[model samples]
Target: MTDPYERLRAEAEAGRVEEVVVAVPDLQGRLMGSRLSVPYFLEEAARGGFGACVYLLATDVEMDTGPGYAIDAWDSGFGDFVLRPDPATLRTVLPWDEGTALVLADAVWPAGPGGGHGPGHGPEHGPEPVAVAPRHVLRTQLDRLAARGLTAYAGTELEFLLFTASYREAWERRYTGLRPAARYNTDYSLQGLEEVEPVARRIRRAMTRAGLRMETARGECHPGQYEIVFRYDEAMATCDNHVLFKDGAKRIAAAEGASLTFMPKFDEGEGNSCHVHLSLRGTDGTPVLADPSAGDGMSELMRHFIAGQLACLPDLALLMAPNVNSYKRLQPGAFAPTGIAWGRDNRTCPIRVVGSGPSLRIEHRVPGGDANPYLAVAAAVAAGLYGIDNRLPLPPEHTANALADPAVPRLPATLTEALHRWEGSGIAAELFGKETVAHYARAARAELSAFERAVTDWERVRGFERL
Candidate 1:
């Protein structure tokens, strides 16, 4: 049983692979990239791929230059940082029409002779600097889980809405009298899915061709909404595939004249959630979280992990719900959980414990589909690791309504509160680093400032004559 790297190298050498596209997910969950030749990537750049500026991760959704990042500024000269390719993530891009392959890598301090290529776009010069990248931070958390003799298995349920054209087209038309890819709210309606079967089939086929094990695909709660479930894999791979999955889905959808949106709440009473299912396995591959005799087949370790997550849920809110629009889904009875509670098969609870065999795991219902998968997984894994390290006690299970039960803590009510909590949180700072945390907080504040300066149509409609 050779490792994934060896297999991928063989595949690449055999001419089974074409170009290698290097990518990292940006703030708005969009994959940003610069493609490199396979030979260059493998020989010289593979160990340390090309270096891009650190500001790539510092900006907002619009890529606007932001303020308050202590590391980068107009004066300090935002320098080039390294992107170290993770060969484990290499895969052939079967979904694309062209001959190409893809891999996900970590942005790190380039490790090469004579240090990293210094500052500029030129090659072969300078010394490596000390810096923390998002993926590297996540790898540290994953290493912590491994140290505890625990391996994590996880899955993400992707929910997204489909419209006929680009967002610009829809917005310019006032989103009125728009045509959905599907006709009605087709929750489990196979007939509706059939109407979009060409695109849906491509999504499944492409994902499978890319080596992702997809379980099911069906229509979701909203008119154009759809959901796809992937078979569980190792925690890190789960998040890696998620980024590729979204990119693949969107590309396939666009070819078929549809646009995929993972926005939390696209419209009033219409939202999509990315539910993550997670479990821990012992060294022998048996689930450590499953005990038939325990509460809901959940072991003490599982309880404590959930307890740690709940205790720090507020601080993790920013990671799970990154954008300003994401806060809209926090309202009750909207199928998105507002309170932090776990129960056996309870959809209302923030965490739902499911399965009975080795698959017994938790489904965290808090994250929106738009969350940056790297950051989201890192935050969750960090909290769970804290639980295992401290031997934290799990709270009593909540069988009743979590929202009505005042005992279970609720998520941050608004983006403002969430941002404040993220800024002040010691756990977040420790996990994400001062620079990363500060950059995101500053970006959020910039967005808030922009929103304050604008006057919306609603304001004029409600107060134009009265005020």
Candidate 2:
């Protein structure tokens, strides 16, 4: 068997592929590039990259032109950005778009005109920076780690709620009265999984076929919610797998005549969570943060990473939970952290220090399943690096209810607060470039503004007759 990479290279070079999909992640983490014929991919895109509008970064999840963006406006003409395909990431998405191999792309600035010979826009001097793209942000943070002679590996526990209703049926019902695959809380129950087995089986097989490494699958605290854990890989690959797996899962579930949502707090029952587990290793392949003799077997480096997360959580909250509905899931006692705190093997804390030896890592629980893994992971890495660079002290682990402790800083209680923190955050700006921070913060504000103008059923029912 030729390893996957060799197979991809052979196929790409030999023109054996049909549709070569070049995908670049937008601010919302949605794959936002286009499908090209293999000839165009090989001739134009594989090296030179295709052109796309830069406003893709500014658009909200609703596709509304996001306000307050510093670039790509009516005045600026929404200039073209280069979608630089990374051929190394080419792989067949067998379960969904079979016969089509997809390569992830980086957003860069297009050259002046005909080919690379356009005046000053040579290979060495072209404007290739994608300052607002999430992948670029993650890559920047990863490079920071590399500069320290360290590499970070991360694994995410992806959770989503499965409903018996088909997507159309659920939408017609306005997401009401859809049967949960399970009838009660089924956390870690083998029997509980049986209830959602068909949907689960389809998802598992799809992800497996797509080459997503499945580590474990289990039920969560809610009736129909389940979590699939993947093996940890380097930060870039981990986040890439996260996005691909999620897109694959949605497609497979819809195909199976079932529907699932990663919406945090699908009603009041349970909020889907993507708990992140991360560890650092030296460039030489030795673990840097695990010391057998240290407290909880965590090196000072690990503690600093945790400390960094604690300090930066508020500013990064909007990036982790981009939507307004996401904050509703941050309620206390919902298996989600409400404050910035850490504990040894504690689920209640924002950062949970767990395992020992080769497994020594911290599980960051701040992000919802709705998070764009690229941004979330990037924020985590940036915060970790900040902690290391600043030599910030990791506070004593919290043994009590973090929400009840007034001393403990709360996770930004709303998107508004998060945007405020994000705008003023020196750490976040320093971590993920100031311009990128401002761009995303503007998008978040736009999302918030849209939410506020809408009158929901609850609003009408509560105030229509009473007032």
The lDDT per prediction is 0.76, 0.82
Per-candidate TM-scores read 0.89, 0.93
Report the CA-based lDDT of candidate 1 relative to the real structure.
0.76
Best by TM-score: 2
**How many clashes in candidate 2?**
1
Worst 10 residues of 2 by lDDT: 111-120
Provide the RMSD of all predictions against the true structure, rounded to 1 decimal. 3.6, 3.0
Q: Write the per-residue lDDT of candidate 1 for residues 257-346, one digit (tens) a residue.
A: 667788888778568898888888986787898788874667878888888788788987887887777788878767788888878889
Q: Can you tell me which runs of candidate 1 are displaced by over 4 Å?
A: 1-17, 111-132, 166-168, 171-177, 293-296, 430-433, 463-467
* lDDT accuracy of residue 131 in candidate 1: 38
Q: For residues 242-265, what per-residue lDDT tens digits would candidate 2 score against the true structure?
A: 888887788778887889999887
How much is the lDDT of residue 322 in candidate 2? 87
Model 1 per-residue lDDT at 408: 69
